[model samples]
Target chain A: MPFSVSKDEILETVHMFQMQNLDIRTITMGINIQDCRENDGKGTGKKIYEKIVRYARDLVKTGEEIEKEYGIPIINKRISLTPLSMVIDGLSCAEVIKTGKYLDKAAIEVGVNFLGGFSALVHKGFTRGDLALIEAIPETLAGTERVCSSVNLATSKAGINMDAIFMMGRIIKQTAELTGDRDGLGCAKLVVFCNAVEDNPFMAGAFHGPGEAESILNIGISGPGVVLNAVKNYPDSDLGELANIIKNTAFKITRTGELVGRVASRRLGVPFGIVDLSLAPTPAIGDSVADILESMGLERAGTHGSTAALAMLNDAVKKGGAMASSYVGGLSGAFIPVSEDAGMIKAVEDGALSIDKLEAMTCVCSVGLDMIAIPGNTAADTIAAIIADEAAIGMINRKTTAVRIIPAPGKKEGEWVEFGGLLGRAPVMKVNQYSAADFIKRKGRIPAPIHALNN
Target chain B: MEESKKLIITVLGHDRVGIIAGISNILARANVNILDISQTILQGFFTMVMVVDFSGSTVELAELKTLLGEKGRELELEISVHHEDIFKFMHRI
Candidate 1:
């Protein structure tokens, strides 16, 4: 059979060919709706809907024209906003839910896939609006399809909020119980963050950060399959060789991201921030960071030397990306979301990985406590300790991190909770039984460690 | 659903003799026009970026992608063919 054949390796090689040497991943639009406020939630909701649709109407068309002229692939066209909760004061939980619907409606009309900023920022303490919005997360997430939310509960300077962490553990459990039919998956759209960045372009937790200028475009790039396939060639390659292949692959991937972000920024009339060069593993089996390590020869993840492997993966992704693009920011390492990555799911099924090991990995990766579910009655203080520990790590390391954990109301350890359709399912892993009341009860910003400032 | 428009062909990864010749031959067979093509090799990495006009071809974009992808596999090189517009629409804000 004489035939020309294209391998995954070759297809990935020219994956970003349209760029004229430009590589594009995501094009995120930040829209401010502060002016859309009204005397009541109902009036404000209408304004919010109209304003978003009107402003974003030309986005898709413009993207098309640019793609045609420039020969680039713009993978995602998304929108972020000023947290709607910030605008809708005196609005009941029901009204906030309506506003979320409006946000979803506008996104659909404009043909954008995802929209974020259904959020709160109460690391220090809750405000009236923040509290109201926090209360509405379960309902709002269950009610809307596209509105993503985040609440920053920890920061380098402000530290973690034990009260919010405590409340959130219960809230996640309650939300799961309410949305049990939907796999209690509403939590996937929301992330409780420590040092959440303003420029991230990925979702569930990617809000337009507070420092965003009027409206700017940011890009996030992911191609775990590309990296996985690149490294796959040398099945018997050693650690250094495997690391080199990952670095080389990421350099090209990041270059693609930089090219796309700059061009989009120019077209959209907004300045571009850094490119998030995260591996961003998908639910697909072959496209996982864990699978990459397994390919490097691990029986399964979370054994003695697992952290060293992860540390190298994180460092190499950064080194390559930093060289490929000057505008690199956000969490640039491989995302290890428990439900999202195939190997992690299998590890849980095999009982090889635990919550503590996952937490330990967060010390090296971009986000914290990703896609994990716990028992409903897990004490708020215990949850607080988890958040505090993650916060302390982020504070010490000075990297952007987040936690989007769910506590399934009645589901105990080893029970599988499914958040169907791309969100995936995960067997609830074990959390520690020991209490840390004294540590969590102190409830003040753990002062930034002296070692953080060392150059 | 927008129609795919404007084609871009890129070649990258390892370099070997006849890499471009084989790929360009496929485009020629399809009656596709190469509007622009650029290739560079640095640090032992071979990179090539091209713009193709499928407006002149009988094959759909996917067919071309598949066709060239095959050639790429034979040579152990990376090759990509795209609608110049999809990537741009995705990139352009």
Candidate 2:
């Protein structure tokens, strides 16, 4: 037979998009804005705006073209720039907010959904710029429509920045209060990360690092529904067999991402960065990471044995994704955001998933305490304590973790706060009554773990 | 092997007469060359996969997709056209 694809293979790929929701989650263009810096903050802001509008003007159009040609839905076309703290270093807080406005205007003009990198890296200690950026985060996020901010407050080698964590807890609350009219929607776009990766294509934690090239295109592949269906197909198969099926499904999914990334790179004339093989879930019914866990014999996502199931699923995804793509980078594991995932939201509402259980689950998966809405009256110190816990996990385990918790102002526990769209809606979950004010106040550093001295 | 410009057109729906003729008519009008075709009734559903070279086609891929989509709607079938590269990348190394 003349080289031809088998019928099964063709149908299998088609069914993934037709019935199952298999789509590229994001096509992020990482642009280094270190060159946009100037002595005056206004000049820096103007240069950054012109540069982003010039560089990413065709990003959304190119994404749409690829989606049309390849029949794959490219959900969001976003741009990530070098961490803004470095660019805004030595600039005043007012200047930083003006830069954010310029960035926001550039994002809207370019037609991209979100522009990331209103960020600071103070994992070890705070620089003047990092402090200013952190202080301006609430105001910037509250004022801008599409500007996202992230702060890398901890790392395995750098340990946890307790002072920054405390500051972020206050900042998170301030952001919530600033955007209280929208139910703390500003916090939805702010992420506090531990061991944050530079090439991460997902928001609200995507930021182009200083180490990245001038311009690179990174692709994040999402196929939780496809994997969930695969797990459901082999109901009678054992766990090992089921894992193999998931790996194979992931291999195929990553291949699609690899193809799309290559095509986008070629068309955009930007170097292809990496395929982030993350199983990012959405608010859709079947597209859920929690559903995959439930299908794998768990009664619910947060009940007993959930951690073991998530660990295995996460490992299998990384293994298969690694084999499929040569240049695999970013947070390439399963993302379990509560509001964004319908199954996860249900688990929380049904009292099956708690913040404590979510913390345990994050140890095995990717990210931490994502899109969780807590009571408005919950202490800022409590939120800082949660970040400290997640940062400690990442520091000891040498994996990326982040906290994107929203303390919806005026919302009590068990009440619903709707952010709508991809940000999704979340029920305010209860937090611990105990305070960690004293502990949070004693701020310095947690010191890097023993493994940090590997040299 | 040189990269193939072939597109796989898969039509999946209830079985009906003149499905192939209708699709082939569109392809022939566009000067497209059909290389191979495979059809089977997969669990009471009519499934057909056709490999066609579109280099000689008169229309662009986007226009062809729209035309085939319109034809598919008329035939009450779900039709999809994909470049062979996607399959090669996924199934092969």
Candidate 3:
């Protein structure tokens, strides 16, 4: 054949873009900002702002160029930085909020959508800076439009930090209240994680870990629509055959990420990090991971056997994606954010999905309790208990899981809480009336698992 | 370097006259060299895929894409120009 790529292959690739919504979800530049630190917290904000603006100046332009040249849509260009606590060690709460403003300004200046890492890692316990950043999260997120915050409250090695979990419960409630008029939109920009990955390209959970290089570019690939179409094309395939089909589809999708990442890295002069194999969904129709599950013979995403289907899908995705890219990290599985995926929203509205069921689904997927809306009256203690439950799963399973639940202030169950755009909207779901106040108040670290002794 | 300047242009629409002629005219004007072209009609739909070397062109890829896009709208056809790397990366190891 004289053609390097056959006509069918070329048309198939084009059909994926035209009909299947395959896209590079994000090109996240992780910039280390330790050099911007100051002992007095005095010129730190200015230095940080200048540093980010300097490093990520051409990020959006580069993303647009790639999108144009490759004829593939790159939906987001974002930046993540070294966890804020380490950069602002011993800094006051005022300094934390100031640095957040600078991050937001830098992000706006660079024309990127979001800037992550107004964050802290307190898996075991909180330092002064960590506690300050956590305390300032509600105000920081409310004060700035594009700054995202996350707190790591647990890890398999360090076990669950119950105290941090309890504090995050209070913080989440406050964040919702802070942006209550917008249906607790602030909570949508905040995430609490267990076993948090260092190079996550997705937000509000993404933060450049201390272990990363000076600067790196990570890619997040999105193609639930592509996978759904692939699975739909093979209605009669057996489960094993279906898995193989999904793996092949994922291989093609991940190659897009690998190609884009390499090009963006070269253009930005940043080290190529990893291709996140997560099938992140959006509010757009036909782009739902839930839809992919539904196409796999499930009536709904949360119905029986949903977990098994999702487990296979997630495993197949990683297996195929790992082969296509040398570096595959982050929460590299299917994300089931209710508000973001129209299929998931419909499932929740139809009472096919519940918080408890979502928690269960989390065990087999990359992230946990994502973009869920609970009743405004849902107690802080209950929210903490939810975090504890998710953290326990991640700890035992040794996988990354996160909670980005919003308690839409003053909204009761069945009411809609709209965050609009990519954040999407969700119906306020009912939470347990029973209280976990006593358990939550007994705030101390949950000891590391027995498996921690292996190393 | 020549390989880097190669592009694959695809035109898809209902079968109509002057589809290739129109595209080739634009490429000829822009000095874009067509290396290979294979087109066919299936189920009354016309599909054309062309491999063009832009190494000899004075116009930028973005400019050519815009010109083709405007022409595509006028002809009621869907035209896309993508770097050759996109196809090779997705379909090859």
Candidate 4:
């Protein structure tokens, strides 16, 4: 038969748009700021600001224009740059903080919501610049509104950097204390990654890798509601059949990303990058990845079969997305950020989900320990151990994983800490009270897995 | 040239008289040519899909979308106008 969209199919898609929350999550313009470096730190910061503003001037406008034309809601216009640690090689921590201020200012000027790549990749070990940037994360994040920071501490090939992980735990705790007035909001803007991808268009982990083009455009598409609605239609279907349905739905969703990415790239005059088909959730009812899992015969999310269900969902999403787009990279899987998803928040509140369950779930999902809120009394070393656990998972599996947990200062377990907007409210879930201080203090690099010997 | 500017306009609302007349009148006044039209009333819910060539229209696509949106609000209908490329790209290879 000739290829044609039937009326029913068209109506279904319309329903997805009108009722279900199907929208483009982000259109990230990756601009290289490596050339903006100067001999003087101040001069380099100014150059970086000017370069980003120049490259991303039309980014927000272009995104808005496309949204109006295509009738698709593009939620965020963002920018990612070359990692600050690399660009500010010889700069001090003060200079790096200044650079972050410039980046925040540029993002505000360009009208983008967030700007990423205030990052350091120390999967093996930290350079001087990397250590300085990591040390300044608390002050940098507290000082800037739109700047996001990430530190990659492990990779399958390079092995886990236990030193960096330990340092990040302390940095995360300090970040929380620095922004304690807003329920440790600084921690929400920071992510700890293992096997971090270069062209990821999502925050708080997106960064421009050295291998990337000078400038490029990447798209992230969101549609957990669409998938959940599709799954609900097949109550009696087998797991294999359910996977097929999700795969088909994901194909359609990724196609929209491809279309939007091409148009955005053409309009912005930048090379088109990947369409990251991640099932990112929002704090709206029915717009939840947890709900999708719950729809597949689970009593609730965080139950026993949840891991297997999430693994299938993640794999099927990637398989379908890979087939739909020619360049499907980034962390293209289901994101289980608790605060961002209404279902997850409810699950946590109802005692159906806990920190341990979320950690287990992360083994199969895209990111780890994401948007989780714990008691303020949780020690720095415990947070470090949490990061170490997540890093180990990513290192062993050879997949990208990250931790974006918040130790809500003074908040007890079951209490709520609201970050507002897309960084939604999170209930402070209980973390293990036992100490890992000694284990964390004995830090060194964990050797690379045997799988890394493939080359 | 006109075919290249094809747009699919979908109108969804409770069944009512003059729904098509109201839409077609605006299209004719705007110098937009209707290439194909299909509509159905299912369970008292009126749904209409129209393919229109916007190359000949006087106003920009953005302006037309706003006008259609206002008309939709007045008629208590949910009207969406999307470029044909979206459907073609999604359904085809």
Candidate 5:
């Protein structure tokens, strides 16, 4: 069937751009560095550096060109690589840190904001390289400016790696202490995931999975404000009608992302991977997932009925995005990262939102316990328990979930940590004072859920 | 003759006299041919959408956009010049 553009549709889209804060969030180029591995750590680091700079040289230029021609804002151009641990087998901590610096340098040379995949996947067990990478994270993150890291410590099939989780808890605390002067800013660049997808274009969780092609471009599109505006139009609409509106709006947003992804892929000569249809928010007002939920008729985001609202919103987005694009991978739902969302920050400030309530909301949303700031005194064991809880949700539900919490150093509850830009400012919230130390100290894999036995 | 490159220009602001005239003057000076035009006033606010042929224009798209932006600023209006492809791709398939 032939498609015709209507004047009203044109105006509506233009209005979305002008007034609604609609924009393509990120165009991430995933480069596989598996082949860059060498017999020595220095050789591998040099090879990885050359490969990334060569592949991503034109990324920013192309993104700017597309943004200008399409008249749509492309907020970030980023790169994700094959997990560094895989290429740093048997490497020392210093070698791993050196490799991280190379990744950081390459990112700066290419003019991308961040470079991901300083990661290790130990869903089952950790290798020597994984252990070294984990050990090197605090120094690597503290030493480098643009490198982002993630570790997959759990999966539905492999169960939760309590050992890794326990270690990550300590690593997170040490990272906070090392970057304490900056309100534990290094933790903001790290993520812990369960069932983490390979082609996610968002950071700091994005890493090019082994199953992916050598190189591909994935797009993450966001329009929380657009969805909120659409939902507000139907003040008295029934639940079903409200869901329909969200679905239709997501369809248009996803279509725009697909168009941008295809064009960027063609221009960059890399295969188009997927469009992550996540309602990623920024610190800016009017662009928030929590506000969208509130527009669905809640007095506040973390109050009662918030989870149900979030579940419906996530489902409708997936349904709409699935129809609009041939391929939909990554975390394709509403992200409830606190610092990055204005409504969520307000909800936290109003005492309506707590870590527990955010945890409950994560059971239905795309990610878990994201961008939350905890009091500096929060224990490492408590952080581990938080990761374990979120991982269990992702594992049992057979979906991807992640935690990116920052334990602000020397900051107490009610104080704010300002990370600036897309990292945003997060008001420090309290964590449960009760100890999970004994539970976390039991370092072994939590058995896979019974339902994971699909075979 | 080369086929004319199509463009969409949208102008939105408070209702005022000579808004269209001011915009048209800039387009005429740039050698852009106005193919179709639509304008309306709602709640005392003015909105206009124009489809213009830029193939015969003396300036590039970037230069034309800058020229229109300056005119819009002088008239206290918000103006945007977009290649027609963006609308076609977004509103259609």
Candidate 6:
């Protein structure tokens, strides 16, 4: 038997593909090293490296087989692990920094583009290990080119930890000032989270959770363009049809996710976890979350029903992903990164989107206060204030959110910086313009929210 | 005689209404009992997995397939039936 689809339908799927006209974005291997620690940070990092390299040796070979089997490209094959800090708490900060370099080396050795889990989780209070991990980030990130770091400093149920925010503020400043001249882009490697998720296959922030068994594989699928094409033709389509379109589009996106992930795992010698079929918005003019809203008939993204619209989109994506993939994990939703989304930047430039409104939106998407481009003249305290607010959202929601604001040193509000290509261009967003020195200067823990006491 | 075997049937192709109902109806009419079935539709494509116990069938495998193939054409599906032994050998985890 044969299935016949029109040539136009085939072309539509092809056109809506990812960077390479491929639907499968990433396949991330989650390696569990509970059995590989040596208590010596350097030695442990070495063993960790060996384990990952050995486990992932077949990854590329397997990936090729799946690509042929499914006919969708799986672009990146990478590894994530339970936070190394959790496994090597006895090591000194310098040793931990050394560990990061080794992990980076391992990634390069095994042919993966990046390796994650140079991280710590201190959403409630800091442990010695967590503190060491946090302190090691600047040097670790600077020392390694292929390692990504993340710290979950807040969750939905816990309010933002002002202490962690203040520390991260100084850390960001230090990292930027240290690498400030070389694009000072060291800060790009780290993510600060509220309710940071475990199975996310995307990066600068994909860490294997401690709760996972020996190892598993997960995939993150992104095709904002695909979903856009679904509803773009229906400018006057009702919201119900729009949602159904999103749902159907998401189903296709996620099935590709499931097929690619399943094939990747079979090829790479690992069990499958979840396929995070998120319609990740990019800085491309046509693919932003705000653009999706505009296509849904909103004049711009920050309008009255924007949050409701996003919530609906998020729900539809989740439902479709759930149906298409057996294991759905990660911050699997439409991303609304301001700096990474062209439409969002335009909205911010037009004064339609604001830091306050972004915070409100993060309550429903993946990554918080993300890729926001703020004016350089903005005080460090204000930056910290922005982080604190985003962290507050994470602390209360138990979802992973992050702030990746680029204070492009000399750029002012409404100024534009062209990152070009995938990173995209960003409009210099306006900050409070006023000081939050008093609010941020009073550096103390913003204790957990009342909901955290639940059984 | 070949009907007295456990087989795995995979259905793949563009998703439209009646694919599931039509396929299952054919299997049931041939005295095949479905042990498990799962299906999903994505990007206009549909795939389904069905495990059937065919021990009580009197119809020939070729005849049943011919019937299913006629319906498969109407629904735009690709159907393949494989014995459990071949499936397990290829898919063992």
Model 5 DockQ, alpha carbons vs. true complex:
0.40
**Model 2 regions more than 4 Å off:** B1-4
Q: How many clashes (backbone atoms < 3 Å, residues ≥3 apart in a chain or on different chains) does model 4 have?
A: 0
Candidates arranged by TM-score, highest first: 3, 2, 4, 5, 1, 6
Q: What lDDT does candidate 2 reach at residue A278?
A: 91
Candidate 2 residue-wise lDDT, A339-377, digit = tens: 999999999989999999999999988988899999998
Backbone clash numbers for all candidates listed: 19, 0, 0, 0, 0, 20
Q: Please provide, for model 4 over A1-455, each residue's C-alpha lDDT reduced to its tens digit, 9 standing for 90 to 100.
A: 12256677667777878889989999999988889888756788789999988899999999999887777889999999888899898889888888788888899999999999999999999899899899989999999999999999999999999999889988999999999999999999999999999999999988998899999999999999989999999999999999999999899889889989998988889999999989999999999998998999888898889899999999889888888897998889999999999999888888888878888888888988899999998898999999999998899998888999999999999889999999999999988888999999999999999999997
Q: Model 1, DockQ value? A: 0.13
Tell me the tens digit of each residue's lDDT in model 5 across B1-93: 121278788888998889989999989998998988888885687888888888898987777888888988999999987667667756565
Q: TM-score of chain B only, all predictions?
A: 0.83, 0.95, 0.94, 0.92, 0.90, 0.85
Model 5 chain A: weakest 10-residue lDDT segment is A1-10
Candidate 1: tens digits of C-alpha lDDT, residues A17-127: 422223354677777777888876668878988987876787776666555444455656888888766787678777787777888888889988778888888767777
Clashing pairs in 4: none
Q: State iRMS for model 2.
A: 1.4
Cα shift from native, residue A182, model 2 (Å): 1.2
Tell me the spans in candidate 6 whose CA falls farther than 4 Å from its real position.
A2-15, A18-22, A157-159, A283-285, A349-351, A416-421, B1-93
Model 3 ranges off by over 4 Å: A39-42, B1-3
Query: Model 4: runs farther than 4 Å from truth?
Result: A1-4, B1-3
Q: Write the per-residue lDDT of candidate 6 for residues A1-455, one digit (tens) a residue.
A: 11133323333444454222335667888888767678677788889889988898877667755553333556678889888778878778887887788899889988888788888878778888888888888788767777888887777666667788878876766665555554445666677777778777877788998888688898988777666667787887788878887887777778777766665666666889998867776655566678777777778898778888888888888887777777888878888877667788778778888878888888887767766666656677877888888877666676667887666666777777664545567777777767888999898778777888897
Better model by lDDT: candidate 1 vs candidate 5: 5
> Which candidate achieves the best lDDT against the true structure?
2
TM-score of 4: 0.98
Better of 2 and 4 by DockQ: 2
Clashing residue pairs in candidate 5 (N, C-alpha, C atoms within 3 angstroms): none
